[model samples]
Target: MAAVSPSPPAAASIDRGDSGLQAYARARLAEGDNALGLAVAGYRAALKQDPDRVEIARRSYVQALESGDGALALQSAALLDGAGMLPRDGTLLRIGDALARKDWQAASALTDRMTQEGNFSFLSAIVRSWIAVGQGNYAPPTIDAKDRFASLGQRYLDEHVAYQALNHRDLSAAIPAVRRALVARARDGAALRLTFAAQLAGIGARDEALMLLPADHANFNVARAAILRGRAKEQPFTPAQGYARLLARLAVDISSDPAGRALGLRLARMATFADPLGAEPHIVAARLLVEQDHAGAAVQEAAKVPAKNWFAPLAQAELIDALAASGNLAGALALARQQASVPGAEPERQVRLGRLLAESRDFDGAAAAFRAAQASYEPDKLPWTLLLFEGSALEQGKRWTEAREVLERAARIAPDEPAILNYLGYAQIERRQNVEAALELIKKASALKPDDAAIADSLGWAQFVTGNVAAAVPSLERAALGAPTDATINEHLGDALWTAGRRYEARYAWSAAAINAQGDVAARLAAKSEEGLKPEYAAP
Candidate 1:
């Protein structure tokens, strides 16, 4: 991911002939250009004049890490440590460096510091285990049976322990750790299987390793194919790489949860420092950056994903969202179109395009893309949800005839789906077509999803449209009471009240509708409050 800039240096500071200030301005400009190499040099030079500027030093340290300048980063880390202002992730940086240099002594010291400072045990314990593995002294981290990521973490730890044991020719110890990691996540996480299988193969248990990766298992197919063709090799075993993988995965887990996102961002940045060539860390960082409303930075971060990386698809997906979040809908659409046009993936790629188009209100394009997604399926095997996707797109586009056919198809496929029933019934109610049948459909939907405000609204409106004003009054009242803030439901209630000759209460409902209504709906609600419903709109 690209290094993020803080802000442009002030104009007065430009080329001030004071070398430190000039270097600082240069550093800031380099950061703005996403040139971390130049930024690192500029910040390093500027820090000579004022190494204690917490802000500059911090920024310098960050750029060094982002640029994979280990020497520069460790130097900055010491500077920050001396000032007692080291950032939370600085310790991890120093630890990773120590492990990489094979200085297990220094790495142990760093881990001890993390433990003393009360870094989350879930993380620090795992880090300690890896440091021990690097030193050929394997100590399994204590398991937290309840930790959300414990299973995944142990799977990784067991891989390292097994790999190191294999190197030590201890088949008894290696075999158990290998079997445990393999069985713990047999159906997912290719990395675990790949790494463990490699250890067995290294120990000349080739047949047993092959047994762990059944070629027909969907999860193993890609790895199997790559291995067969000699195009892929299992990751080289190193405690440093294992540490990076753990950090990257943990960053993803934490960032995915809203409450943990703040710390997740820091871990993501540090993961990049840990694995400079990695793709996952960049994507995770980009996603969290976008959530924090830094879309431009996210775009830069995601764009750094190598085009040929296995995660290229995910990176592109992130780019589309980041572009859209930054209000570049046109760019988003363009990228979505390019991805959807890829030859093989079918439904997923096309569905992405359809959703993007639908969200942009280009329902015609959405309908077309969704239809294309169904081209791969046999008529009898069409997924009901995909049909509903296409139906809803057509419905929103005001193509009712097209929408009704597809939606009815979906309802047949999934007879108990209340949302499908409500959507189809309400649409028919709006057009006054087969009102009696539509009403029955809505009644069934309401029975299935008894408390859904929208379904209740549909049921009441269908009653009102069928000239059952007596029944509509109570039904509409129930719907309105259930969804007090729904403009459409309130308007329906207003219509029923006016038909029942309750003029004052009718106006009150109309006023309520107008409160949150917008565009033509708002105007119509306001007019109804003043002029009352037309006679034609009233039920007999």
Candidate 2:
């Protein structure tokens, strides 16, 4: 969820504590990134000083929800709702709670209130259907209700109809709705296909079930695994599984919109409430939590996935990311290593292992892990980004020739990729080979991303090496301005400035560069600042 706007506080709340503390907390929450943890702490401190401040209480609720502290959110939400100021998310939770208790009357009443509020009105049909099913009265939606969803809304409409039809043992009705939902959207068909496959399996239609499976879709892997298990067991989707599927699909759909995280969280939580035994719902909620920088909560959600479920490996992979994000890098690496050794672990886990290794500067180990990941892809269809990563690792390891070979192949496959062009061009310039060719490649890369500081630095260095010091100075200056603290860019700018007779500024730039420079570069920059450029750095 985006950070909440602070409500106007009463005079008593202001006088109760340092107003500055409350203001600081609000500012930090609004600032985004990893500030949620600190914001929560700040809000807690402020709230302790003024427990009756509804504004502060509401802000705490938002921070808690955004941080994926659902239990805390529920508590804070209770306070707000008790004060007759429950937010939209709180309303969703309230409705979900009603549904959980099989209080159809309360659920229907809450849903009506939600509709009146013009929030989550899209959920009215689904919730009503659930209520109907619970009451042993399955009401098929009217034609007008079905017609209201002819376009993109049709997907949700289809889900509602199919779910009700399934509960009523009306497969003929369910099948057409499933097909329309699947056929209408090229993307997001996994959940619909999964539901359809499960229903088919329910009726012993094994061939139809297998036929509905999509090829190589990442989001559908768990569903595929579940379908396979059903095939083996000769069974169908349980009612809880069906409910979980509906909630999962809704969560996925909402998550696609940039402003839908809050709604997505509510639906995911609802899914968990509706089907406590289903691992997929928890995994979905965990992923959304991770996206909002709630790694601790994400880890908690992932931990809820039963170890025996087919989704356990998926949970473990997500836990690896959560651990890393929560600043438990060693734990993440240990888990990654364990995951990698499993006989049939997913290739994505190995890819993750390589990234963690690369971050730790184990370049050789990272390259090996990357190779193992690459082996998972078909040879002819390897992704360009993968090559770029492997090439970068090789370059950082000082395996220059291998790096060049890999980068060149990447450039061929994705000729317009500015990163590949810049890296390959910069590598050529660094080795002092084919200066003119390097200049052309860097120029192409710079044209593609004119404001990129690293590419600008490469462009400047290439010009300086080819005896164009005057021409190089402007580009180098731009690069330094764009990335003021990057040692290499500042050092490059310093060299160009000295060559252009700006000697005093050259020393100033070198001093700044020296702060972050290391090893040979630091020594070289020191010598240049005190005396002048070595013979190597002088104008050609």
Candidate 3:
């Protein structure tokens, strides 16, 4: 009792410790590597000594919850509560997590406690609404809570609740809620009103819905307005001009959003009957249809584009692809010829036409087209990738000798190219010659892109042919994992598994390949598997 410590120094020491703890906490949070884990560990250690540190405990609890440590989050939450500085957000997050896990009783109790606290009334009300929904209480949330939410800059919440009301088939309740939301933020909120208006029209409240939509909302673009005008016409065919304008505006709109693109396509389809000479609509319709995977419909729509338009050649190419995909080889070939004959066609068009011709089994015509294209431009001037197409076309035509010669030239020109190496190696493998050299080439390609499924399959196939069936399984498995949907890889994996004495797994894989394989490869694999025979499957 004789020696008393200086009060100022003791206070300074406590302040210094608090500052160090704060620094440690912030540093742990700022770190990128497992920040949540490090932060929780750092804060918990500091808080053990500085037990009254409310902010630190709150942050620690948040980090713990975010890192999915529920017990630790609860411990920190209790600590913050004891310290009398609990964050509203932390409580809400914890309650939400409990609700997500279907701990409704715990969530309800927590919400009741939060409501009694009176500090986070808005948040508590939102949670109560969600809890009521979870409990199958279909009644709309209290009006007082809705009004409080609207006052808190959360009008979207009102609209969202209205949408839920609509989902519950209570459009009458939804109408007033949505109208309130629109009134809160009209300029930036026109879209929501428009959507609600559409719903109201569906519910036989067309006059009321029309009254809600502003006559000249700034966000309403010409195309959308035209569509709305056309829809509002008394006579069914009276708004033909408006429909044409809508189709024209739609061509520009499709570039930005998929929904807009779809709407554009519909308007263009309608415009075709209204104005057949307007090629713009049909061209836009075809492109949008292609995007939607309606390739056959795309081909039909593209056929309506005027021949004088610059899009004619591009449209013909699309038709070629669509017809090819539909197994209409004759139609595809005809479209390819049309694309080739188009005046002043670009080099890409020529390449596309030649590829389509080769795809349709008109390899001779493809060869002539490729030869002409090659002659028209120097090798150094054209894209190096063009050589791959020309060489592969030669291979498909059974001009193996010419194919090999061209592929060899391409290999020399682009020695580090993975696709060239894989193609040439697979070509050599398919020819049943140069097995050792093909293995080496494919191994090199795999080293360059270890995760490339096609190259892995080729390496596995090469190993299988060289009688190293044991080494083939790992490579084939990797290939199958990387390209689970590829019929060729699945077929190869099946063969490798069959050779490895895994007959049951092999049969399952072979069945998958048979179901999904395309063209001649599909027919061959399906027939071979059905015959209970393990034939050599080559890579394409």
Clashes of each: 0, 0, 0
Candidate 1: regions farther than 4 A off: 1-119, 123-125, 136-240, 254-266, 375-382, 433-518, 529-540
lDDT of 2 by residue, 125-221 (tens): 6666666777778676533445444333445667667656755567789778767767764544544565566666666666666777754444345
Question: 116 in model 1: Cα distance from truth in Å?
Answer: 7.8
Best by TM-score: 2
Give the clashing pairs for model 2: none
Clashing pairs in 1: none
Candidate 3 per-residue lDDT, tens place, 298-370, comes to 6676787565442344456566667766577777777666656654444555676787777768786777677
The lowest-lDDT stretch of 10 consecutive residues in candidate 3 is: 233-242
Ranking by lDDT: 1, 2, 3
Q: In terms of lDDT, which candidate is strongest?
A: 1
Please, what is the TM-score per model?
A: 0.63, 0.72, 0.47
The total of clashing pairs for model 1 equals 0
Cα error, residue 298 of model 3, in Å, equals 1.5
Tell me the spans in candidate 2 whose CA falls farther than 4 Å from its real position: 1-51, 67-71, 78-87, 109-277, 288-294, 341-346, 450-457, 467-540
